[model samples]
Target: MDLNQRITAFSNLSLFLKNFLSDATKCEATLNDFEHLKEELQQVIQTANRHNAWFTPEHITQALSSWSAALQKDNLTTWLDAYAITSSSEKRVAVIMAGNLPLVGFHDFLSVLITGHHLVAKLSSDDQLLMPFLARVLIIIEPGFDSKITFTKEKLPQFDAVIATGSNNTARYFEYYFKNKPSIIRKNRNAVAVLTGNETPQQLEALGDDIFGYFGMGCRSVAKLYVPQNYDFDTFFQAMFKQQDVINHHKYANNYDYNKAVYLMSLFPVLDNGFMVLKEDTNFSSPISVVFYERYTDVETLKAELQSKADQIQCIVADDFSDEDVAFGQAQNPKLYDYADGVDTVAFLLKL
Candidate 1:
C-alpha cells in the first residue's frame, strides 16, 4: 500500500478506538465493519487487569485515549511529512517490546509499519493480547497489511533491522546479539522532576500524575526529584494526597508495605504519606512505591550534573529546565514526533 493508504488505515483505526473509548456500545453506523471487533476489544479491556494487574481498565483506557488523539490523519500526515518517506523495498524490522505500561511499545510498532516495512514483533508476555488485537483491527481496516505483520512466541525470524527495549541487562545482550544488524537497543531510564518551592498546588498535583501513572512502572514515570535545600514536605505531601487512591491496588500496596518495612528495618530515614515514600537518595531509578529525591544548591550546577548523566535520564519535567524538558504531567502523553531517548525512530528506520 502507498503512504496515503497507510495513513488512512491508521486514521480509521484511531476513530475505531475513539468510538469504543467514548461509548463502546453506541458506535456510529460508519463503523459497522468494526462492530464485532469493538465487542471483543471491550472484553479484552475488561480482562486486561487479570492478565497483568498493572493493566487496569482505567490505565488501558488512558492508553487507548492517548493513541486515539495521536493517530488522527492530520497528526500522522504532519509527522510523516517531516521526513521524505518513500515506498522503498520493504525491510523486515523486528521489534522487541517492553510491557511496563499498556501499549508501551506501540510507538515503535507504528514507526516500523508506517514506514512501509514488515514488522516482526515479540510481544512481552505481560502485554501479549493488546498489540496483536490492535494488529488484527488494522488488518481488517487494510487487508494489504495482512502479510506485513508477524507476532512470534518462539524464536524471532530473520529481519533486516531491529528495535529492542528492555532492562539494562537485556540491553547488553541485545547489543551483543544484534551487533551486526541496524538496531536501536534501549536500556532502563527514568524521568526526574525539578521542583521549586514556589510551584502552585496545581502543578504539584499534576506532578503526581507523572509519579503515580502506570503504578510508577513506565520509563517516563518520575522516579526522582530535585528540590531546593530545606524544602518543606508539608505542601508536596498534601498535593500528592490526590493520588492516594493508588494504594488501593493490592500489588502497589504490597510494594509500599515491603519497601517501607525494609527501610525501617535498615533504620533509614524516610518520609511517608501512606501511599508513597520519599527517600533522600541520588538515584534516578526508584523502586515501585518509592520516589528518590536530592537537594540541589543551584539550578545551573544541577543542570550540568543531569546533562553529564543524560544517558540514564529519559525525560526532565520542569517549566524551563531545558529545551527538551517535558511539561509538568506530559511525560506519558508524548506526541508522535516525541521519539524515545531522543532517538528519532523514523529517521533511524529511513536510514536502514
Candidate 2:
C-alpha cells in the first residue's frame, strides 16, 4: 500500500475503535465490517484483564480512547508531513514490547508498518492480546497489512533492526544483544509534576488524572512531584479525591496497605488521603500508591537540576513552565508525534 493508503487504513482503524468505544451492540449499524470484531475485541479485553491484574477494563478503555483520538486521518497526515516519507526497501523490524499498559507497544507496531517495513513483534505475555487483535482489524481494513505483520512466541527471526523497551537492566542486555544492529533501546523513566503553589482547583484535579491514570503503571504517568517551598498539601489532596475509587482495585489497595505500613513503621512523615500517600522524597520513581515529592526553592535551580537528570525523566508536567513540558492532564494523552524517549520511531524506521 502507498502512503495515503496506509494513512487511510489507520484512520479506518480509528473509526473501528471509536465504534468499539461506543456501545458495540448499538454500533453494529455504523460499524458494518467491524461489527463482528466488536464482540471479539470485548473478549480480548476480558482475557487481558484476567491474564494481568493491572489491565483493568477502565484502563484498557482509556488506552483505546487515546489511540482512537490519535489515529485520525488529519493527525496521521499532519504528523507524517514533517518527514519526507516514501517507500523504502522493506526490512523486517522486530519490536520488543513492554507489558506495563494495554497496547503499550502499539506505537512501535504502527511505526514499523506505516513506514513500509515488515513487522516481527514478540508480544509481552502480560499484554499479549490487544495488539495482534488490532492488527487483525487493520488487515481486514487493508489486506495489504497481512503480508507485513507477524507475531511470534519463539526466538525472533533474523531482522534488519530492532526496537526494544524495558527496564534499565534489560536495556543493557538489549544494547549488548543488538549491538551490531541499528536499534532504539528504551529504559525506565518517570514523569513529574512541578507545582508553583498557584494552580487552580481545576488544574489540580486534572493533575490527579496525570498521577492516578492506569494505576500509575505507565511511564508517562506522573510518578513524582516538585513543589515550591512550604507548599500546602490541602488543596492538592482535595483535588485528588475524584480518583479515590482507584483504591477499590485489590492490587492497588494491597500496595497501598503495604507501602503505607512500611512508611509508618519507618516513622517517615507522609500526607495521606485514604487512597494515596504523598511523601517528601527526592527520587523520581515512586512506589505504586505513593507519590514522591521534592521542594524547590527556585524555578531556575529546579530547571537546572531536572536538565542535569534529563535522561532519567520521561515527561515534565507543568503550566507555562517550559515549552517542552506537558500540560497537567495531557501526559498520557500524547499525540502521534510525541515520540517516547525523544526518539522518532518513524525516522528511525525510515533510515532502516
Candidate 3:
C-alpha cells in the first residue's frame, strides 16, 4: 500500500474503534470483549508456561479495558507516526518484541500498520500467539488491512529500519546488525513508583494493577518503589495480598519458585508472599514477583531520581503529576499516541 492508502486505513481504524468505544463504555463491553482475547491467550501462557505468563481472567478483563481506552487519545493529536513509509521507505522491519506481557507487541503492530511498512517480527518465545491472532482479527475487522501486513519467521531482509526491544547487553548486537538503518532500539526498561502518605486503597489497587498484572514480567510493571525511609512496606503488601487468587496461579508460582531459589542462593532478603518474592535490588526487570526498592526523602527527591534513571525507566506512577509525571498504571495501558522510544509513528504515516 502507498502511504496515502496506509494513512487512510489508520484514520478509518481510528474512527471504527472510536465508534466501538462508546458501546464499550456503555455496556462495559470492553471488559467483556477480553473473552475474545482468551482462546489465544494461552499461546502466551504456553510460551510462559515454563516462566510466568499466567493470563488470569481478571487480567484479561483489565487488558481489554486498557486496550479500549488506549484506542482513544488520552492526549495525542495523531494515533502514531508512519516512520517507515516515508519518501524513502523502510522495506522490511525486523521487530523484536518483549514477551513480558500480553500484547507487548501492540506498539510494533501500530508501527508497521500505520507506516505502511512490512514487519519481520521475531515473536518472543514467551509470547508467540497473541499478535498473529490479533492481526487476523484486525484484518477481519477491516478487510483493507489484509494486503498490507504480513508476518515472517526468517531473519529480515535488508530494510530501512529495525525496531527492537531487548536488554542493555543485546543493544550492542542490534547496533552492529542494523548500524546503517534507521532504527529504534529499546534497552532494558523498568517502571518506578513514588508513594505519598495519603494513598487511598483505590490507588493502592491501581498499584497492584501495575505490579502484579502479567506477574511483573512487563517492562511497564513496577520493579522498584521509591518510598519514604519510614514508609511501611506492610501497607503495600497488604494491598497486593488482595490478589490471593493471582498468587495462586501455577504459572506465576513456577516463576516465584525460580526467583525465590535464586534469591536464597544469593542470600538476598526478600519479602515473601506464599509464592512470590519482593526484593530490594535495583534491577529494572524482575524475574516473576521479585521487585526492587530505594527509599526517597520525599516526592521531589524521588522525581529527581526518576529523571536520573529516565533512559532506563518507562514511566513513574506517582499520585502527583507535578513536573510531568503520569498516572499509576498508565504506562502499562498506553494510549494510541504514546509512541515507543518517543517516535511519532502515526504522524509519520499521516504525512506520508
Candidate 4:
C-alpha cells in the first residue's frame, strides 16, 4: 500500500480507538468491520492490567486518548510532510520495544510501517498485547499490513536496520549486536521541570500531571525538579495536591510507602504530602512515588548545565525557557514531530 493508504488506515484506527476510551460498549457501534474487535480490545485492556500492574485501566485509557489525538489525518499529514517518503525499497526493520508505559515503543512501530518498511517487532514482556492488537486493527483497515508486520519472541532474523529502546545497560548490548546494521538505540532518560517560583496555581497543577501521569513511569514524566534556591515548598505542594488521587492506586501507594519508609529510616530529609515525597537530590531518575529536586542558583547557569547534560535528558519543561523546552504539563503530550532522544525516526527509516 502507498503512503496515503497507510495514513488513511491509521486515521481510521485512531477513530476506532476514540470509541474505546471510556466505554467500549458504547463505542462499538462506531466500528466498521472491526466491531468484533471492540470486545477483544476491551479484554486486552483488562488482561493488560493483570500482566503489568502499572498498566491500570485509567493509564491505558490515557495512552489510548493520546494516540487517538495524535493519529488524526491532519496531524499525520503535517508530521509526514517534512520528510520525503519516496523510498519503495522495503527492508525489514527489527524493533525492540520498551514497556515502561503503554505503547511505549509504538512510535518506532508506526515509523517503520508508515515508511513502507516491514516490521519485525520483539514486544517487551511488560507490554506484549496492545501493539499486536492494534496491528490487527490496522490490517483490518488496510489488509496489506498483514504481510508487513511480525511479532516474535525468539531471536530476530536478519534485517536491514534496527531500532531498540532500553535501559543504559541494555543499550550497550543493542549497539554491539546491531553494529553492522543501521540502528537507533535509545537509553534511559528523564524529564525535569524548571521552576521560577512564579508559576500560577493552575500551571503548577498542570505540572503535577507531568510529575504524576503514568505514575511517573514514562521517560517524559518529570522525574526531577530544578527550583530556585530557598523556594517555598508550600505553594508547590498545595498545587500538586490536586493529583493526590494517584495514591489510590495500590501499586503507586506501595511504592510511596516503601520509599518513604526507606527515607525515614535513613533519616534523609524529605518533604511529604501523604501521596508523594519530594527529596533534594542530584539524580534525574527518581524512584516511583518520589520526586528528586535540586536548587538552582541562577537560570543562566542552570540552562548551561542542562544543555551540557542534554544527552542524559529526554525533555525540559519550562515557560519561556528555550525553544526546545516543553511547556509545563505538556511534556507527556508530545506531538508526532517531537522525536524522542532528539533522533528523527522517519529520517532513519527512509534512509534505510
Candidate 2: list runs displaced more than 4 Å: 24-32
| Residue 172 local lDDT, model 4 | 96
Off by over 4 Å in 1: 24-29
Give the lowest summed-lDDT range of ten residues in model 2.
Answer: 24-33
In angstroms, the error of model 3 at 127 is: 2.8
Question: Model 1 reaches what TM-score against the true structure?
Answer: 0.98
Regions more than 4 Å wrong, model 4: 22-31
The window of 10 residues in a row where model 3 has the poorest summed lDDT is 22-31
Ranking by TM-score: 1, 2, 4, 3
Candidate 1: lDDT over CA atoms?
0.92
RMSD values for the candidates in order, in angstroms, are 1.2, 1.5, 5.3, 1.7
TM-score of each: 0.98, 0.97, 0.77, 0.97
Could you give candidate 3's per-residue lDDT for residues 243-294 as a string of tens digits?
Answer: 6666577777777788888888989888886755778766666676677777
Q: Model 2, residue 212: displacement in angstroms?
A: 0.4
Name every residue pair that clashes in candidate 4: none
- For candidate 4, lDDT tens digit of each residue in 1-352? 8899999888888888887665555443245655578788889999999999999988888999999999989999999999888858899999999999999988898899999999999999999999999998888778999999999999998788999999999999999988999999999999999999999998999999999999999999999999999899999999998898998899999999999999999999999999999999998899999999999998889999999999989999988887887888899999999998999999989887
Residue 300 deviation, candidate 3, in Å?
Answer: 3.5
